[model samples]
Target: MTSRLVEHLGPSNISGASAVEIADRIRALILDGRLTVGERLPSERALAIELRRSRSTTTRVYDILNQDGYVSRVHGGGTRVALPHSGTTTVDGDDESMIDLSIASMDSTPGLYDATVRSLPRLAALRGTSGYSLQGLPELRDAVAQRFSARGVPTTPEQIIITSGALNALNLVLATVGRRGERALVEQPTFPHARESLHRHGYRMLPTPVDVDGWDERHVTDTLLHGRPHVAYLIPDFHNPTAATLPDSARARIATTARNVGTHVIVDETTAELDIDRGWAPRPFSAFSPEVITLGSMSKIAWGGLRLGWIRAERGLVGRLLATRPSFELGTALLEQCIAIELLQDMPALTAHVATRLRDGRAAVAAGLARLDGVEMPSTPGGLSTWLDLGEPISTALSLAARDRGLVLPPGPRFATGGVLERRVRIPITLSPERTTQAMERLSMAWSDVHAGDEPRTLALPHAAVI
Candidate 1:
């Protein structure tokens, strides 16, 4: 565990920092969702050895962290991660004063209430059975399959497995197919939790760069050919943060390369339908190759609280997933499955509602960026957030500065695998227009503070989970 924590620390320039400064760096890591909550920290001696710093300095670092409620040292458990609780503000609890931008999600869709009320009757019918649906309700799976078929991929209910969410679907796939020592190709500045999941599954990562301009096709094909990673986890449509969709040609090239290399391509389409104004979307990645595994969820299109998602794989792989799923979870909630069926039928309405909200948010964010110098928000017609180029590596500093003013913004580094991407940050379009305007105002003030050389190390930050 200590070795893993040391690995997570990466290449920190800790040689010249004071103990307080070192503590601040670790605190920033915690706030970024890299260190995470409840994880054990390295012992002072181990950390000192790894960092090549004095034992006294390491001891003081832990002391400062403990004093700040960032850690608690149990007599025999070593130091465990934690966050300070306060009456006025808290990381683990609710504090209405803070504008949390950590999660890129919106409120329930306008039609969610009606959908839930309609699903109640279906729920009553399920009481006669054991309520365990390992492959999800038949109706829901058919609905999901039909939607996939409509998108140009021929799918069947037999190839679908409903899970709690997209993340859960990914986990089930990993558990079934992950080879501990194999390599997995992933996107740099990809979904943080997805990266963490790959790490936990023990696949060494081969990161391919993805910027606001989108992916480099040559790099992807070359990596697939040379690295021959066991799997490639990609968000091809409306890529998260950057909102760069892969053109059909690029997808075809990647799919062909993966076939030649015998690499499994796991496509996350959670953000696929998040099209605000992108008039057209390419056919599903599966349409390019039958070997592709696609994960989809209603979290973005509808609401995350619904806790519903599905995986579309080949029939044989779907059988493997169903066989392995009981070791982790029995089945996805039956009620959510029923509700998803209704939601699927009303996707046109849901998409229109989401598109309107995203449009307003995009405009609000653009207006806010205009007030700040050097912060560039790219053309984001879709996806939940836009990746902002800060024009300098001040993302962590700026995040801390924003925290002091009641805006919780995860630094750019949080989105990447290692502690990099300081020149970028993700601002979600999930917020209402009014809240986004307010967040930008606070962000502008924070930018000014950073430029004025106001110290941000002393700022107290609430540690919220990044979705």
Candidate 2:
């Protein structure tokens, strides 16, 4: 494990790099999720020997890291990783002053409050009963089923199982059908939380590359044929971070290959309906293969606070999911389910409101990227974020610099495994126009700082290629 962390640090001695530089690199690694919180660090003596640096240098590195709240040294626990406390302030003073660009979600839709109010009546009717719906409310299931049918995948209410959210639904699916110590194919530069979920379930990931353009059909098929992973977790529609959608032909080919390999395709459709002038929509991935288990949520289209999502699978698989769910959660809240039923009734208006916000937010990002030199912004047809190509692998440095300037943007490597994708950064299109532009301005300043060498020089993993 220390060797891998050392490898991420690259060749130790640059002409003038010092303990501060080393600490900065490690801090960026932690921020990128390359080194998880609570993971142990190598002893200073051991790290010094590995890096061919003096023990004093290693001590300073740890001291600097500890000062920044990135690590803690217990009596006999050695040094364990940690995140800075939320109350920690930046150079500018208060933490609240920072413009957080990490979350890719929006405020409640214009219809959410009214929908919640409408749902109260239904909630009152369920007050006398147990209120525990393991399979979810019948009305919400039917509404979700109809939405799937409209998306070009024929479905019945029996095929849907509701959960607390998309992540919860995903966890339930994995708990039911996932195999431990097996291979799971995932997209490089995919959602970080999904990667964490897959890891917690004991699946080793075989990552396929995805970029602003989209998937490489050849690479995906080759990986499936060669890796023969037990499962493939995909965000096919308006994929997170990159916001690239898989085309119909690619979807069909991937589905076929996965089916042939006996791989369960878990397609995350959380960002599916966040369309803003994409001018087209592909069929639900399940349409390409009946074996695909699709996850959907109201978090993006409606509000994250709503806490509602559902899974669409074969009735047998739905039963398995229901059986596995109670071990962790009794059921999704009844009131939230009722609100979802009402929200589903007004999806058209909800989606339209989201599209307008996304459109403006996209414009804000484009305008912001316009001011930065050597940064390329892709045409985001329809998604919640714009993936910027920085032309150089300086993303980690840029993020640190941004944080100093009161902006909290996740570096590109945060989206991938093993600290790769340094040439890319995902800027969300979910913030208000004003806040988005402000973030861009701060990002511009941070970009200048990175090029000026205010932050340490970091390297991507040698074998990890940015697509």
Candidate 3:
């Protein structure tokens, strides 16, 4: 923020300079750390008032900072700091503090490996092991098809293709069905990697807005028809970042719109099974649009390292996708496939175990965030993170300030559709109870500090990354 001893640049002084010069000075102040991270800037109106410059001139400077990532606004929180250089990882290496709310994913079910080991004999029972088939292994395909078929969507082994993980499945489907430079429809504030993947392939993005009630049917439908999109990437169950599940009505509508408009929909159902509430599973959205491409990953339900996922599409499309899959890696480990096969067979017990842990973990984190002052906990029934609407967007600064206290969080833009969703931050359920509480406490302190105009202080994570 500008010092209280404001420089009231008179009309003559203001007339002597341009907006670009003011922006340059502010930029230098931020880059050199004189302004400090998470420090609020004088509002555009205030700056104009002090500098005797037009509001447009001051606004231009603020816009420059936003583009440079020096600052951003939260929904209700005033503009504060943007993501700091927290080195982006912890000493543990695997957990990125950016991936807050560790409670989002439950660890693998206990009997998963045991079940896989037990299945080896059955796999060894196969007479001959041959080279990779354009189609995945028949036995595994048949077993998976049966599972999906039971959910009211009949599938044949020929329609399924195995890939290293859901990412590969998504890439192949997009490669096959998506055209470069064409708009790909997606939800606002979507998974960051999904957006990156689309960008990597040279496809343009068309992000539609979503809220607690679900997707605006008109907005999505209009985009598909008029935008001339090639792919619709959707996360139908317990979506990442937002933790929202598209209702069945919205699901059916989206699927129908995609199919009718000749847009291939890639549905990512990685978190389909994590609903701790145990509500009735909405029929697989793919069931409503067989022409759509659907992707699934065992990583969320099993383990991230498993690297097992599958694509369900019509048989010919499956072959086309497989031909492109090798551009990435050869294949997922044969062992991981065997593991996923066993997990499916043993899901009854595995689901029970995962459910217990996630349910408790959610409780632990929710309880903690609720106690923080100035934090407005939004009502999200059953996804990993609580969208704590702190009634402000200064979250990015608070996040940076919390770094000195040891917690790292993703800024709101990471999930934005049209570069909106500023006031929000996602807190996944992946964190354990104890660590999450400590993290929240630090966040509260950061919030208090920044809102009160104090210099944002850092937190010490026992293992926080030092840049």
Candidate 4:
């Protein structure tokens, strides 16, 4: 963990900026959960040598951290990350010092509180049953199935299985389909948690690159043919982090290619309903091929705390998943299912509400980024985040600087398995216009601090790479 932290700190050439810079990097690690409460930090001498700074500078940085309540040092005990009450804390925990941009989820939708209150009467009727539904509540499944059908993909209740969320759905699929050491093809810069889930289930990852303009069909097809992966995971619409929506033609070609290679394409549509400026809604990927498995969630569209997501697959596949699900857990929650049913019943209104918020957020963030001289912000039509180019492979440094100003951002490399994309960072637009403006202000300040020693750098490219 210490070595990893050192790598994330990157190199600092400006000697005068070493102490504060090192302190900021350590604070960023703690806030990002890379460092936790009661975790002992490396010795001051060792860390100073690793950061290429003098021991006195490192000792002063530690002194500053101790003064700020970010770390505690006992007489004989080494320094450790402080507890929440002591000063440092997690994002959702008590501390309000830092603003979290690491998560790309939204707050509760407008009608959620009312929907929850209204669900009580309906939920009271289900108190008699055991509430252990291996598949899901019949009404909820029917509602989810109808949603897919309304989107032009024919679906039935028998083809839908509710899970905890998108990650749970992905885990179930991987558990059922993946084998140890087998290749799992995925988008180069896909969701970090999804990639972690695939890795945890023992599948070797095979990455195919994506860009702001969207996927390269020829490359995707060639990789699928050559890699012969067991599972291919893709986020077709308003992809996470990159915010690129795959074109229908490319989707069709990729689906056909995967089918030819006997690979199951798992299409994640968690961000599909967040369309702010995309003119038309494309048909679900399953519409192109029956082999395609689609995953949807209320987390992004409605609320992250809802913890409800569903998988749409063939009836036979659904049965297989249901049979295998109990081995992991009994079933999804009943109350959450009831809430999802209410949300699904009024999805049109809910989607409209979120669309308005996202539109304003996108505008505000875009305007804010424009104020910065070197940052490059992409034009994202619909998604929770916009991928930004920082002109050089200093994403880690910039993130550390942002942390010093009380803003937390996940660096670009977190989204990819390789270190090739260290020049980018994903900024969430799910925040309100006010918060978005503030975050951008802090980000600009951090950028200035990082480039204070050198001239501001800029890169002009045809399209931003996905990962």
Best by lDDT: 1
Q: Point out the higher-scoring one by lDDT: 2 or 4.
A: 2
Tens digit per residue, CA lDDT, model 1, 1-467: 33665655554644577888678767888776677689988899988988888999999999999997889999888998887775444322243377888889999998999999999999999998777689999899999999998988888999999999999999999999999989999998798889889999999989899998999889999999999999999998889878999999899999999999999999999999999988787989999999999999999999989898999999999999999999989998888888899999988999999999999989998988898888888889799899999999788889887887778899887777556787899999999999999889888888998999986643455554677
Any runs in candidate 2 off by more than 4 Å, and if so which?
1-19, 31-37, 45-60, 67-69, 74-76, 82-88, 91-96, 456-467
Model 2 lDDT, residue 254, Cα: 95
TM-score per model over all chains: 0.92, 0.91, 0.75, 0.81
Give me candidate 2's TM-score against the actual structure: 0.91
With candidate 4 superimposed using the best TM-score fit, by how many Å does residue 31's alpha carbon deviate from the native?
6.2
Ranking by lDDT: 1, 2, 4, 3
Question: What C-alpha lDDT does candidate 2 achieve relative to the native structure?
Answer: 0.84
lDDT of each: 0.87, 0.84, 0.66, 0.79
lDDT of 3 by residue, 1-467 (tens): 33321321123322556665455334433432334467776777877877777899878877766765657867566666453344543432243343343224555667876877786876675436542344566777888888789988999888888777787777777777767778888887667667667866878778887664456788988999899698888887776666677878888887888888888888887777776774668889878987877788887777766777888888788777777777765555556666677788877776677666666666766787765666666555565566667677565455555554445565454455332454777776655666666666666656666677764433222221110
* Residue 307 lDDT in candidate 2: 86
Which ten contiguous residues of candidate 2 have the minimum total lDDT? 458-467
Off by over 4 Å in 3: 1-104, 119-134, 457-467
Q: Is candidate 1 or candidate 3 better by lDDT?
A: 1
